[model samples]
Target: MVDVKKTSTTSQNVLRAHYKTLRPPNALRGNEVIILRHAETIAEVFPDWIERCKLDTTQLYPFDLNMPVRIPQRPNMKEAYMHDPPLSEVGRIMTQIFARELVVRNAIPRQIYSSPSLASIQTALDIKNFIGNQCGAICVDESLSSNRHDSKYWLTEKDMTRLRYCIGEFCVELQTEKSSLNDIVQDMKNLVATLVQKKKQHYVVLIVTDSLAAQILYDALSGIQSSYNEPLQQLYRKAERTFPPVSSTVFTPSTRNGILVMEPSRNSLRPLTRIGETTRPDFDSEEYVDAKP
Candidate 1:
């Protein structure tokens, strides 16, 4: 088992500090969706897996349950892992930490939806077990999996440089026409609508997916419509480079709610307020800390 204590203490401290300030967007009291990328995967981040890959590049990467392996790139160090990898020990620890934090803050979701990938499913299950009754059922949804989308290939250092340049160029295009909503985006929107339209008015739904799907959902819910607008040839050119590692993004209905993007080291929730709008004073200032209910 990967020792959670070995992980950076800075991240844990940051989570502890900011967790005191997290609040359910008043506008989304009953309806809100939080999208998160799955924790690290065994095939991708485990030191043991890395050593194994180094020892036998020709052999198939092993899986806990003989899961598939999808290599999109040149089978580079980063992309050479099982297709449906399970969470690494570090990932399991992180999930437990996050779940415990949510429970302490009284911010546990009522419903959890995970991508079909083994890593996501494992993360969701860990969280469900940790939070107990504070969280509800876990559903696996294909729409949230990156497998449904085109492959994103990452190559050597030179290729990564080119990919970054492409992402910079694409960000500029975002200022113009919004990219047409694709089938995946539509499916995600439909899922959110279905959740929100339920008889219960207050529902907090958590979606655990790949970085690409998480980005798309963030763009959709925040009304940014920037990142996912490009065509396949242009979009996903550098999907991995777009977002920071292990980030959690929250989306609520009201403009006043703004968008909260949290990462492991960031001490405060970064708010992206809508144009010409200001967030509530309580939310705007971190000075006021509310007692956990």
Candidate 2:
């Protein structure tokens, strides 16, 4: 368990404190699979504290981190957080530092995939900026989305538009229903294949997703899915009070021959499957299409 009490509750500590999780010994490397939980959102679903779930512009994030806490107000034009809430003010800064750390580690991802949520996309974009254009439009995958199964709680139309605009083209959001663990494995495979097609120099793929979603991939890679769901430890690994708050899991054999790859790590690993409907938003309506890149 990470000791959140030792340091100030500021968001920067969230990143710096987690340093123990990524020491060079087991730190990220080329041709590895990085399953990361998205940064903090304006309203967090799985807040450190359970009471934050209230609509007090504070509690909403604990239950549905992607959704913000809201109160009754006069009907007016919505802000970015109204649809699919983006990262909080602190989350944005934390993510920038996280991206820089990845670069410092020489673990810059060749391709970045994200859950179809503003928070996840926001994290992916920051890494994209630090790593360069090799990351084309952030691959938005439904399979990598939050465990909140209801579309009503998912990204809004405006959220999708922002996503489309962020990617610089029509974005194809894969739709899914109750995806099993293997579903994510398949997505990893797709990413692996794409990474393989690229030059060997390009390695490390980042999947910016929810804590629950990231755990699914981590368990699949580490072969610990059924071991025990250790609370929220999926994304935040703890140490003997000496380690900082930790985040990140690198899949073994995530690469073979200097390219990304995935295979069964345990006997329980399931076969991959192709699931979900494809929804492509028109880029013509994108207001930023005409803007310089």
Candidate 3:
């Protein structure tokens, strides 16, 4: 997302070449990890080859279902009108696509779980209908409930806007260890302990919750503790409540069964290789192109 241009064309070429030969990061190489989006949908974002390489078909699950699929503000919105406030028409379609994508590609998991939220529940049911009910799909809302502070108050559209502002401030502040990172950290720990304990060697668990809650929980699983390595609860006690949209990231633990990591495309995530702070090679350098002309 950050497009910091190279200082020179030569540097740009070198960077491109570097990528050509470089690999991807696999922090969770062998096993699966806690998902922090609408839940299992995070896996929907990654290509199937990545899952195959990691051999982690069974150990995938989301925390909850996706609700309010189309925020009126979203661009190119599909499934705009539906009885359910959550899960737009496009959402249902995309979710089905998500399921078919997995099934056609042989990425179906042995089990599925979701939060009790209206959206999460609907998403799970939709997925269940696609693959049949025997895939072990169910709703687990307790672990994926709204934030504690959020529970204390009602949310209005204006409140949602302010909450976004607060979340941005919180993200920046967390990076700096400034004032309100503790609660965020604790919430994360609770989410991780729950998701991790449920994992079998090949188990995939999806615990869908609100977006900000998901991010906080996922961050916790990555072992990102605060300045004192203190629990997130301590931090939460000091900060105000806020909600943010979910950002997606995939994490695979070590895989002992199926393909754990693959490089289908050059842009794909390859196995771990350390080539820090290196520049790419120039394509036009005598080695590439028809210099005869």
Best by TM-score: 1
Order by lDDT, highest first: 1, 2, 3
Count clashes in each candidate, considering only residues at least 3 apart in sequence or on different chains: 4, 15, 50
**What does candidate 1's lDDT look like per residue over 1-293, in tens digits?**
86677666656667553346766533323345667677767655454664554424455464533222432233453443334445666667767876765555445787787775656766787788888765777766656755542223312234434433111111100111222346667777666556544514466677888767776665555444343555654444334444322446555543234533221121222322335532111212221133111
1-293 in candidate 3: lDDT tens per residue? 64456456557566452336555332233234323234223223333322332323233222234322223232211211111124444356655655554354333444554543445555655666787743444534334543433222222234435434111111101112222445544544655555554554564444445554554553454443324344555433221122111222344443336623211112211111123411111223321143221
Better of 2 and 3 by TM-score: 2
Candidates ranked, most accurate by TM-score first: 1, 2, 3
Which regions of candidate 2 deviate over 4 angstroms? 1-29, 45-84, 134-136, 156-164, 168-175, 179-202, 225-246, 252-293
Q: Candidate 1: deviation at residue 48, Å?
A: 9.5
Cα-based lDDT at residue 104, candidate 2: 60
**Model 1, poorest ten-residue lDDT window?**
167-176
Q: If candidate 1 were superposed on the true structure by all CA atoms, what would the RMSD be?
A: 16.5
Model 1 clash count equals 4
**Candidate 1 colliding pairs:** 30-202, 30-203, 68-83, 69-83
lDDT of 2: 0.50
Runs with alpha carbons beyond 4 Å of true place in candidate 3: 1-31, 34-36, 39-84, 148-188, 226-248, 255-293
lDDT at residue 69 of model 1 (Cα atoms)? 48
